[model samples]
Each structure stands twice: as structure tokens, then as C-alpha cells.
Target chain A: MKRILIGALFALPALTAMAGDFTASLSIAPEWRTDNRDSAYFVAPPVVPVQHRSARQDLGLRFRDGGFNAQGTLRVLAREGQTPEQHGIVNQFYYDGDLGNGSGYTFGRKVISWGVGFGFRPLDVIQREDRRSLNPPPLTGVPLAAWEHFSADKAFTLVWTHPGHRHEATDFRDQSLAARYYRLVDGNDIHAVARLSGRHALEAGAGITHTSGEEWAFHAAALYQQRYSKTFNTLAESGGGILAAANPMQEVMRRNGLKAVLGSQWTGTSGFGVLVEAWYDAEGYSRNEWRRLDALTARQRSLNGMAPASAINGNVAWSSRAFERPNLLRENLLLRLSHDDERWKPALELLVTPRDGGRVITTRLEYQSDRQRVSFGLRFLGGAADSAYAQAPIKRMAYFEWRLALL
Target chain B: MFKNALALFASLLATLIALPALAADDIAALLKRADGYRLLEESVRIETLVESYRGDTLDKERRYTVYIKPGRRSLVLMKSPAEAGQKVLMLGDQFWLLMPDTQRPLRITATQKLLGDASTGDIANMTWSDDYDGKVVDEVDIKGRRCLHLDLSAARPGVTYARIGLYLDKASKLPIKADLYVHSGKRAKEAWYEAKTVDGQLRVMSMTLLDDIQAGRRTVVRYQSIVALAAPDEFFNPAALVRNTLAGW
Candidate 1:
């Protein structure tokens, strides 16, 4: 979008030069979904056409001053039958710079999220965030040039992420060179990361976090991607075809991928909480590649009336884009439960996929104050009955938001 | 007869170690005179604000900066706009937070350090002769001032309050009212203190709290400045709380 309005006009002269720290908010959100017409990749009229309702609004802005920083958003959107849109993003626009003693440096497009599990974050190697997206927005930074150093308990960063970008087949816009290392020792913390990328060429990871006493906490992470990719459905990887005339998916590539997570939490001082996690994702999908794509989608729905129902609904809608991956399988598990009270906050989550038992479930609530904030959420999928979220095609989703702030 | 029972068990272990080391040196000199009415140095920064109310209306406000140093470090920074670039830190009984578009720092516990409306441990624990010790049990008068209570406890388990009662003021030792306690010993908030004098000293610039389990809220806080600043120590490192930015520190 005109490079996000020239990075929001280079952060509007640091928001009128000086007296820094500014913020603004507005939000609206909306969302809804449903569509799960008896699965087997439902396709009565959907070869990709699921909006079902939408609304957005956003505004958000931020500024920092001293070493400059900025954040942006604008959006507007609407949808249902479509038509209504607007944009302008620039989620971050950094500067930082300070190279005295403890060192510092950063430059444009920033959001740098070194990960540690909270629903899968195998050492996030440079903002690969999507810890279960649903009601998500705001976070679009990665155009780096960082350098940092600190000590007293240690820290180091290095970044070169997407800087001069090219060769991007994902890995969040690949063109990487990342690094991180942190420590804290006996009170745990620790972390590690490494990235290199021409599309996952050399990744590395490590993590830890520990807390025990005063309401538990624990974490773990792992990663190892020397290359990873997935897409598949070229007739369920060539086990002899059944139908195709257009979309047959296909993107493959693999070699030593791996991801991992493990978690634990327990909070209480009356604001109850609990979490438990588990993850693994050698680029998802593999219980024999989802039983050879569920036996080629049950042999293309058993050649229903002798072929041509638009070639079996366009081959099960291109095998339902493998349930739009984000760990469709490859062992997963999570459980959450929360509360925060003090202008309310609530949560509940559950996910599971232990090789073919698929499930999802979600719930949320919020309230906040001091310049508004309201939220609500819902989600659900399903389990067994031949998993993959019960022959998924989407089964309920809901949302709402409010926000306010306005500086 | 066994040498008079070993000289009466050596004078009862020498008056049980000279009576609690003379009442722990008079409760460490009255908690260093109630930590000089809420810190007057030993590295500082402060600024705070808070507010809260709700029965007499007001309902919310915040701003903070904190900093503090000397051993039990601190940090804070969360100058409201709904908590801008949040941060927390701590370091004696660990805590970290840094959330405002995450750059990862997390690790909190001590009951999530109580959060908001003046609780980053009431905005970076001012002082308590180092996390508290006990003794001066009572003297009481209260409404007519006299005071002296004490009764503390929590020489550290990530302190945020686990028994306190305080009071002080028995003739200017200052601190004036408190209750706080939690970890099931109930009484979750009462506080009070007010003090003034400013640039010519006397301190304790405001505090109020109240809440004892949500009963019309309250809060207050205040201290819009404190100064002395020491700051660097890699900004109390929790991985440098997402690269310092102590702004005009």
C-alpha cells in the first residue's frame, strides 16, 4: 500500500517531534463462520468462498520517540457478499540506534518476537508467529537489520531478517539470518535460535523458561528445519488418480524438519489459570500422509453417479486445502483455562489431534477498561468420526471486539 | 548434681541468644525508620500516578516509570495509553513482563505480581528494610495516632504481600497504616499513608489502596516524581527488558 504510506509518513515526524510516547486505538472486529455441510470436504458451491460474515475497522497507531518507533494500522474492510475495503498497515517502523556501552541497533519494520511456547513456538526463528490465529491482526513487521547486546543476565540478538528479501516461499517471507541467545541461569529463562533461510535452509532452536513456586510455569521448545514445505494432493501423492482438471495442490519438499513444544502453567492468586501444551510438527500431516489423503478422499467419494459431478466437486475442493494447515496433525494438544477478573477476562481452549482424533474448541471473553476494550469469541470443530476435525470444512467460529483508546 | 544441671543449661542458652539479638536490633532499627518514609535514595526514579476510585466515581488512570536499584532491583515503565509498551522487571523474587507487541520476556509468578491499578507490587516496592522481618507487635491507639504495630513476615517468597500489618508513626517513625496480607491470610488491602514536604524532604507522597476484597475499589497511589536515579545495570536485565528505552533517563 504505497509501502504502507511511506511507513506512515516516516512516522509523522515522530508524532510532532518529541514529547514521545503516543498511542491511539479504535477497533471493531466482527467475524462469524459456520459452513460444514456434512464434510468429505463439502462442496455444493465452495471451491473457496467462505466469508460468511466479516467486519473490521481498526485504526491503531503508536509512536515512541527517543530512538523513534512507530506502529500503524487503518483497515476498514467488510464482507459477507463482499465490497467494502480500505487499507494501510505498516505495523512497525523502528529505529532504535544507540551504540554506547551495552550496544543497540534496530532499523525499520520491527516486531521481532523471539518465541517460547504458548501454543507452539518452536523457537520462532524470526517472527513466525501464528500461535493459533483467530481474531488476529496487527503484527506485520519483518524487514530487519538488528544488533543488540546486553548483559547482567545476558542477551544478544542479531537479525537480518527479510532485509533485501527474495527467495520467499514462506518461512514468513524468507530471506533470513537471525540469531538470539539469552540467558538468566539459575532462575532459568534461557533461549537460543538461529536461522539462515533460502526458505528454511538452516534453522535451529532451543528454549526454556521455568518458574516453580508462586504458581508454576514451565516451557520448552525445539526446532530443526533444514528444509520444510507441504502442499500435496497431486492425486494424493501419485497413488493413482481419480479426478483433476484444475487445482491439484502440490508444493512438496522435505528433509529433516521438526518442531516441538511442551508447556505447563498454573497461575492462581485467585485469578485462576492453567495451561498444558504439547506439540510436534514436522510440517504437519502424516498419519501416513493422512491415510493417503483419506484414501484419496474415499476414492473421490466413490465416483458418485459415475464421475462428472464437476469431477467430484473439483476433487473434493482440491482436498480442502489440507485443512488450511497450521498443524492439521502431526501430534498436537493444548488445553487452557483462564480467568483474570478485574474488568473480567476469561478463556478456555482445547485442541488435540493425537494422530486422527482431531478437535479444536475455543472460547474467550474480555472486558478491560480505562478507555474501553470488549471481546468475545467462540470456536469449535470436532473430533473423531474419522478426525481431521471431523472431516472439516469449517464448523462454527464467532468473534466480536470493541477496543477504544483513541490516544 | 551434674554441676547444677550444667549451670542451668548454660543460662538457658544465654537467654536464648540474648533475647532475639535484642529484638533483632529493635526490628532492624524500626525497619530503618520505616525505610525513611518510602525511600529517599538507594537509587530511585519513581513518577507513578495510578488512581482507580469507583465510589465517588473516577474509575481508572495509570502511568508509571519506577526504576529503583540497589540489590532488589525494579523497573516498571508502562505509561498508560492503556499501558503503552508495557514492562515490569523486578529481580528479587524474579518477575518479568514486557508486553506491548511482545519482544518476549514473560516469566511472571509471585501471583503475577498483582498487576494494574498500582500493583507492580504497588509500583515497584518502595522499601521495607529489604522485604520485611517482624517484631514490634503492638502499642496501638490508631485514631489518636500513637500506633506502632509491625507484625510483618515474608522474608521473601516472591513477596507481594504475605502478611504485613505495619502501622508505625509512634511519634514520627512515619508509615501510618497498612494491612495488605494475602496467601490466604486474607485482609487484602487497606493501606493509607500520605505525607508531604517534598523538595525539603518528609516524602511518602500518597498511597491509599483499600479494596479488602473488592468493596467499592479505591486505589490512589501518586508520587509524581522521585529522582535520584541509578538506572543502568543493564536495565535490570530480563534480557534487557526488550532493549532498554529508558528514554531520558
Candidate 2:
């Protein structure tokens, strides 16, 4: 795969010379992380070592000729205390062929995202993008074949994802068949999607977006899954055992899961904008589940002198894995304010979990020129001493990235 | 003889009363003629180049391909390296923007649509007869050329400008200059049109916009080429925006 990606990169210049639209860019990003030393999970010996800083450099290219399109990235990564590594990513490689009467077919890897909402898109069953991630990289397309038909105001699409692959451990890798229907009526956009898979059986969703007057836009989306899965610590759920020798976390499957999001945005003519969104995920941990896990960790911490430090630290580290989930709680609210003034864009975002009074605040700024763009941001995890964000092992993170277009 | 005189007086009064209506028709005809200098056909494919300058020095440049259809439908595709694969679809009063990274069509309001330096409306909308209506206000001389000044108000709610003061060449009825007013009735920008003979027809090939709020900033929009093309209706659909490659078109 690496060899193929390198070869493709080498061919981009030749492709450009031979009658095609080609684009290339170079970017450098460095990220810094701060750890919370006061957290109960933080032990003197350190159960899990953490890296304080990392940097990445990327050379990306994209080409489009007729119905053929390809995009790839060559990356060099370095960490605070590790050797530099190099790799390549084939972000997208697809061929689109047009059929008669407003129909088309796509073969190979492509990015197909259909949803409505900025914070959480319940209808995005295929990509399942994590919207809250900080300083994310370019998305990689999934392997699939799709057929589509379109009209003046309506469209229908059917896709087969991960063709020839069996059910995988993760939902994204699972083999599935998905379809979407979209329509525009009286200034309202309506969308519906359904997916069939072996693990989840079936998932269906619908969404709508509407704009009123000249400044406001409203969107709502909801998805229902026949089955969903979550990982939980067995010790906490059983109400027993202060410490365990091995990891006690295990995955559990449940029936009837739903995810929903409602949001609205208002933009003024002066370039200031505000967005408010709230979402609920059945797969996320509930209030009682967090309380149980918190109680388990507290009970384990009480045995400081009685038990070995490694045992307690190990158990706490295992429990801390709960924070890795996209949403720490089942319910979340997001508020973002931004200003776009032609060349500069600045934004502030706040994510709150109403159940535990937890919140994450982020500030971002970007300056765009004709051929270069610079972006930087800072994020702090805190709010309420007992909140999940406050108790997490990581406290704050900052990052800066500069990008230049070469072609 | 007395009755005949009374009938003739009534006829004269009616013509006097209908004079304003006749003038309105003339105004509409003039606007249509001015529109022809910008849009030669009901549907066209235009290649546009936009350059932003600060004090006569070029600061930024971008390119776009615009497709305009009847019934107020248009699509703008960004071709600049900074915004490659970005598309904006406009249908009547509604708009949707599709970014290259997300591959999702996001709905945007009229105010949000006017955020960029060269707004989507500036690149896509070429005809004024469909979005504005008014009467001729006066005939004046600008730069030694006789011109007719028209005061026009938005007939459609989705227009980027709420009102406009337009000047057209009195003889050719070609658009010469316009003062754009926002919803607050404040002059936002001043636009001057430049026409050139292309393929034996006079067409507005470039437009220069002077910023009213921010002094010393100017934007020039140049049409590299324009040809008659009725793009398939499906390309105008918001949902179909992601699917249409438009490779050959």
C-alpha cells in the first residue's frame, strides 16, 4: 500500500502535464497536550505514559480528469520522545460514470456523507464522523459502490459499503447496504436514510433543514437503531470488587437505540454568527452508569495503604478508558459563536453535558490568503470539580497548523 | 356640439391618467435591454475571475464557473485552489453550500450568502429584470455620456441588495453604474460595468466594485467567457449537487 501511494504521488505531475485539474498542498501542524496531575487516575509511577507534544507534516495532492478523481497524502510524524515516522494515506480514489437520464454510478473509494446539523448528524450512518474532535485530519473515504438517480429537486442513492467484507469488530468496518432519499420542497430540505447490516440489523433516520427570513436556519435529525453496543466495566456494573488484575471492561449489546439532534443558527450581515445545538445518544453512558463507575473508582482509591499502588493504578486506568468515548454522557449541548471577516475567521465553542455539569471550551482562529492558510486553537476540559472532563487524565490541548497550496 | 366636447375632454383626461402606466412599461423594456448586455440568453455558462485589490495592488484572486438557468436557478463552482470542489446551488430564494471536505450540502440564509468578498450572488446573478422593478428617475450626463438613472427596489425577497440606483446609457440602454443598498438602506458598494464587443456583440465583460464600508478595498469581477448553455435541471438540485461531476459541461 505504501509503495502504491508513493507511485501515485510521483505520477501526479505527469497527470497534470497531460490535460487534467491538479492541486497540491503542504501543511505542518504541531499539537501540545497538558495532563491533569490531580486526577485520582494519575499515579506516581504512571499507569499509562502520556506524550506532551507531537508534530506532523503532510504533502497532499488531488487530481480530477474526466470521471476519474484521486486524492492522497504523504505524512511525516514526530513525537516528543519518539522517532519520526513516515506514511501515506489514500484519501480517495474513485471513478464516476454517468448513465443516461440523470443517473450515475461510482466505483472504488469515495467519501459519501449525508446528514443535517453541525454538531451531531444522526443521519450520518455511513461516515459516523466525530464532530467534536480537536485538530482533526482530512477524512479517508470508505470503499464502496453506489448508484444514484436525480431529478430537478429530488435524488435517490443506494450504496454498498465495504464490499466483499464480512462483519467487523467496529461499526465503520461492517458490511452494510445503505440508501438515501432527498427532496427539496417549498424551501425546505428533507432527507431520509436506511441501512441494513449484520451487527446492527437495521438503522433508519430522517432529517430536515429550513430557513426563515434572511438570517436564521433550523435543522433537526433523528436515527433509530434496532440494536446498539456499549462497553462498560464489569466491576462497576456488578457492584462488587474494588480492584481487578485484568481489564474488566467488556462490550454489551442492547436493543432499540436512538440518536437525535436539534440545532439552529443565526448570522448577521456584519459577519457574526451563533449556533446552538443539543443532541442525545442512546449509546452513550447514562447518569446512573457514570455514578456507578465513579463510586467504583472512589472505593478503589480508599484502599491506598492496604493495596499496592500498581494494582490500584491499573484498575483506575482501565476505568478511565470510559472518557475516550465521543460523548461522555447521553445528552449534550453545543454553542458556537463565530465571526468571518473575509480573510480572518474566529470562533468559540462550548460543549456541555447537562447530566454531570461537565463542559469543554474551545477557541479557534484561522487566517486565509490566496495560497496559504494558518489556523490555531486552544481547548480546555473543565467545569464542576466532579465532572468527567475535570476528572479526566488530560486537561488542556493546543495546536497550530499552517498550510500552503503548491499547485 | 356640447356633448362632443365633453366626450373629447374625458378622452384627454384618461390618456393623461394612463401616462404613468405607459412609462412603467418603458422602464421595464429598458431594464430588459440593459439585462441583455449582461446575459445574452436565458441560460448560460460563465467562466469568471475575481480579483480583490487594496490600493491598486492585487491582494487575492479566485476563479469560478457559474451556470445560470431560467426561473432564478444558478450554480457556482469554485475553481480556485483554496476553494476547489466547493459548490453553491441557488434555487429561487433558497441556497445550499457544499464544501469539499464535508461532502454535505448545508443550507445558508440570504445574509450568510453575502459573507464573501465576491458574494455568490455577485458571480451567479447576471440579470436584474427578474429581481428588481422600478421607474426611470432622471436623465443625466456621467463622464460626458448621456445616461438614464433608474430607482429600483427589490421585487424578490432573496435579492442580495434591497434597493439599487442604476444608470444606463440613454441610447444603447446598457448598464453603466449601480449603487447597491443593503436591507438597512445603507449604501454597501458602488459598481461600475465595463462592456466589450465579443463575437460581434457588445457584452458587459467586467465589473469593478468599490467598497463603501471599508475604504481602500476594491473587487473586480471579470468574465473570461460566456456561452449559451442550458445545464440539465438535475444539476440545480441541492441534493444532486454532490452527485453531479459536470466533467464535460
**Of the candidates shown, which would achieve the greatest TM-score relative to the real structure?**
2
Number of backbone collisions per candidate, in order? 0, 0
Cα deviation of B118, candidate 2, in Å: 1.8
Q: What is the lDDT of residue A237 in candidate 1?
A: 82
In angstroms, what RMSD does candidate 2 have relative to the true structure?
A: 4.4
Backbone clashes counted, model 2? 0
Worst 10 residues of 1 chain B by lDDT: B16-25
lDDT of 1 at A243: 84
Best by DockQ: 2
lDDT of each: 0.83, 0.88
**For candidate 1, lDDT tens digit of each residue in B215-242?**
8888899888888879778878898777
lDDT of 2 at A113: 89
lDDT tens readout by residue for model 2, B1-249: 999999999987875665455456666677889999999999999999999988999988899999999999999998888888889888988988888878888899988775267777888999898999988766679888888888999998888889999999988998999999999999999999999999999999999999998899899999999989999999898988776768789
- Residue A52, model 1, lDDT: 77
Residue A313's lDDT in candidate 1 = 79
Show the colliding residue pairs in model 1: none
